[model samples]
Target: MNIKPEGRFQVFANIVMILITLIAIIPLILLTIASLTDNSALIRNGYSFVPEKWSVYAYQYIFSSGNSVPHAYWISLVLTASGTLIGLTITTLLAYALSKKFLPGRGILTFIVFFTMLFSGGLVPTYINYTGVFGLKNTFLALMIPGLLMNAFNVMMMKSYFVTSIPEEIMEAANIDGANEFSVFFRVALPLSKPIIATIGLFIGIGYWNDWMNGYIYLTKRTDLYSIQNLLYRMIQNIQFLVNNSSSLTGADKSLGSIPSVSVRMAMAVVGVLPIVIVYPFIQNNFIKGITLGGVKG
Candidate 1:
């Protein structure tokens, strides 16, 4: 088949998209450079796309003794992995169950799930439940439990994907072949639903990874249980606290100016975000597929 003049337009559009992508990526490149540059150079000179003097001092400072960044990184990794796994499992199962037409009260159950997205108990009640009833405060559970697990939007996304992508005929065929509900789900549906599963997993994982509110409220004393993001926030807080209170605490001889505050803050930002930056591409492929599935008609 001979292509039409519109093919030339498609090429032009592609070039434009490439330009836009480059524009968007420039800041990220600069952030990487700033992370590597020394504090003195950064303050003396303005921000640069390329660093004149490259130093790993900021990263070294974060990893050095008396700093809890390494522990926080480990805590975040555990919480993110655990929360993503458990949350994805529960979301997939619940969404799959609700997707089936024969399941009784599925509509009501879905309503309850959807209701949460629109209205929540607010922060006070949630805090009370986590602290008072669950006693999750100052524990690893506090980091994993609240707001990260089984979001209604993720559940709905999975249900829609399963309904549209996985044919009911295939599920029926599996049922007829002496497969139980669990067997069919594990052997058939789960495998087929990889796109949505990966999509929701990424979303929930990122939420857990970036969460600071849960740590701030629930993990007041237990610095050991702090996630990377929360730890960074606390680090920034501590720096500011020192700067503000240094005159009173340290007297006139010592000053907070000696601390590499600017570089340290930027370094913390880089550290907190680096894991997500590294892991995003893998999940992003499935995330694109998941969104495409939602757009597809049954």
Candidate 2:
């Protein structure tokens, strides 16, 4: 077959995309190298894409000193997993019902959801509600519930997917076969909508993993309930606090020798972000497919 001009253009586009991908990934590669390099060398010589000397001291520090690191890791894992599972389920079911034409009062419900995106009750009122009315302060629910659960945008995405991609005829057939709404949604629609499910799952999972605000606001005084992000936030605050108080904490004449501030901050960032970096690629293809398919039909 003779190659068309369009085919030649596509080949050129692929090469350009490859270059762009490399450009995007180069910084992450540099960060990993810096994380492995000795902090003292990094400070003296400055960071390079290539490390002068390699050490695992950062990782060692994180894992050392009893089981604090392991405990934090477990808490983060549990919160991410549980929050993602529950949030995805609720978002999907609610989105599915709202996508249906016959569902009563969907317009009002959707308006309410969209309204939340535009406005909220502000921080003080929200804090008061969660603490006073809900009594969710300093609990694991505080970490899992606020901010991370059932986002309005994610629900709209799912609703769009169901509206555009799912066939009305197929739903009618399922109803004729004596399947109830719940059965049809779970056994039929949900399975066929794997791409959207995976997409929403990734969104919810990432939100849960990266969230520190809820833990900060509602989880005061509960170090045990901190997420990995929250722990990293506290670590940064502690570093700043030490820097501010160094003159008093140490003798006025003494210096703390820089405290590995930049390197330690970078190291903490790497630690907090490592899991998402590892896991995102596994679902990335599905996420793209979901968004592409969902957007066109909806």
Count of steric clashes across candidates, in order: 0, 0
Pairs clashing in candidate 1? none
lDDT of 2 by residue, 79-103 (tens): 8899889998899888898898898
User: Once superposed on the true structure, which residue ranges of model 2 sit more than 4 Å away at CA?
Assistant: 1-3, 65-67, 251-259
Candidate 1: tens digits of C-alpha lDDT, residues 1-298: 7767899889899999999989978877777788788888888886797766777787787777367777788888888899989988889899899989899998899999999989989899988988999899898888887755478888888888888999889999999998999999999998898888888888888888888988999888988787888878877887888877776785633545556667777778778778988997877888899878944532
Cα TM-score of candidate 1: 0.92
Q: Residue 145 in model 1: shift from native, Å? A: 1.3
Per-prediction CA RMSD (Å):
2.4, 2.4
Worst 10 residues of 1 by lDDT: 250-259
